[model samples]
Target: MNFQNRKQLIVQTVDERGSVDVRELAELLQTSEMTVRRDLVQLAASGLLYRTRGGAMKVSLATDQFRFANKTAVNADRKDYICQLAAQDVQEGDILFMDCGSTVFRLCPFIRNKRITVITNSLPVVAELMSSDVTVNLVGGEVDKERQAVHGLMAEEHIARYRANRAFIGVDGISLQHGLSANSEKEASTATAMARQTEKVYLLCDSSKLETDKYLYFAPLSLFDVLITDTEAKPDVVAAYRKAGIRLIN
Candidate 1:
């Protein structure tokens, strides 16, 4: 397998087994132990795993919340691709609502040229578009240090005052049964509020989030008008989503 595929496999194996030994990974991958060690180091550096003396362990899901910096590193390529597609939905003079989700934050750089107004709660989005031509209006509220975004009743009230032509958001998990969910209630509330004020709701997520449900359910599947994801999304899930009348961009 290629480097990207091999690294993905390593992450999947570690996630499924909770931990993996170097020798076992090397044998399973049909590669040398040196290569396995290198892959483990790379994944560890990305905050996807904890590197050990002779193996690697998956990061503890219970304690490891989705911090902005860490989320940016995970599925970096896929997020970029999804952002590329979502950027096409933007137009000149459009008023957009951007949620604080990591995947939705990727849209900032791609949208710099568009003469649009951005209402956002994300610190990273504000910083990225501050010097660009796009106008940024930050929602006021208490900042969540780990999330690097604004949240709370103040932020939700701020969102309610404005209506946008389109809103781009992200979620920690999405499933047919559980709908859209997030690990933090604050983030979930902010995302839901943004969606409520927009005419069109576009969800920017990677395939990993498909068929998964997190701690809090914020919105239903019908809240989203379009789902922008990478080609890696599961075929069955994509078909099911399409059947449910949600537009899919893969």
Candidate 2:
């Protein structure tokens, strides 16, 4: 393929997969590994893909980051069910904490007029619940445009003041070994603090995240009171969490 055609293909691959493995790229492009590396460098320089250790990642608000919109599309239906199950645990007048994430966003639709107090860092969640009787407080701080979540030291301070009866949170990956993880350290810190402030922590995760590791670690699965997932979840992974004394729900 010509240089222009090859570059387009590389960009397209990363766009579709969110990331591209270098070895796979070389094989697909029928080129040497060195040539693929050169192409990736050019793409990175041109504000296209961001080159990582063994691959290239798509560009987003945070460079090489995934946005909430993209995430909401992944395993959407399963996330909805998990969110539905989470909402059943709420009681009237309960002070709840919801983190900014696609899975948690699903809970907003199910939370009707419960006369509950909700403190959250997610913009979408606040917007969804605006008309409901639920008293929603937006945690103020610098907004993370990509995740559509408010996070930073200022937000963290506000979250520390109130203890929550329950905290519903999500993570980029849920590993039995590594605990919770997110793409950004700031996001992870906000989530970790929210979990600590709550009497009970419920994690909403799709099957895809089970046993997967990410760049930043939030907390171990043992720290969570329960995990709500979908039926597609791997049995072994669920068993691992169950063995750790964590309640797993589908």
Candidate 3:
């Protein structure tokens, strides 16, 4: 492979495995170990990855959040279905707050032409809605580059500035006991802020997230006004949220 193709190959490897060793790249690209080292060095210098003892670890984006490329591929069809279900609640002229998550990103296309004002800190959501007539307000703060979402004290402060009719949030996990959790502390903070500013909070999660717990806890099940999930959600999990007075939609 040529130099350019070799570099692209290196990136594709990291995207697939989340990390790659120099020796593996050497074998795969039919290049010398020193040449692979050079490629790794170049990629690391360009902010593509971080070199470790024998390999490179995909640079953990924004400290704790996974890269968008990593997340955009998982449970895509389920996310699309949940988004379509959630969009049914959104009517024209509504002022809503959409939180960051892959599922919420899928809701963007269905939102076109809706006379709504969307306040969000998710860069992907903002980018998807940029050309639409919907008034989009991006709560600015420290950008979590890997997740491409904004969060921190500044983001929370901005979220407090507006009251929304509905807030659509997603979580890494939810359980009968733990409620909702997030993979990153910043995301938990941002989700909490979004939940607080809205009259009603709807947790949009896929079936895979049901009964799952991650690194950070966000809120109790009672906090969410509704839970929108895919049909694959476990019946017991659905019952748990329902028992907490959280309406369930599949």
Tens-place lDDT per residue, model 2, 1-250, is 8779989999987776565567668868999888899999998999998887667777762252557777665567888889888989999989999998788888988886788999999998998899998999889899988678899999999999989999998887777667787778877888888988999999888876676676777676666788899997767777877888889998
lDDT of 2 at 108: 87
TM-score for each candidate, following the candidate numbering? 0.78, 0.76, 0.73
The TM-score-based order of candidates, best leading, equals 1, 2, 3
Best by TM-score: 1
TM-score of 1: 0.78
Off by over 4 Å in 1: 1-64
Weakest ten-residue segment in model 3 by summed lDDT? 61-70
lDDT, candidate 1, 107-191, per-residue tens: 8889999999999999999999999999999999998888899999999999999999999999877888878887678888888
Error of 1 at 5 (Å): 16
Report the lDDT of model 1 for residue 101.
86
Per-candidate clash tally: 0, 0, 0
Best by lDDT: 1
How high is the lDDT of residue 36 in model 3?
Answer: 89
- lDDT, ranked from best to worst: 1, 2, 3
RMSD from true fold, candidate 3: 9.5
Runs in model 3 lying further than 4 Å from the true structure: 1-65
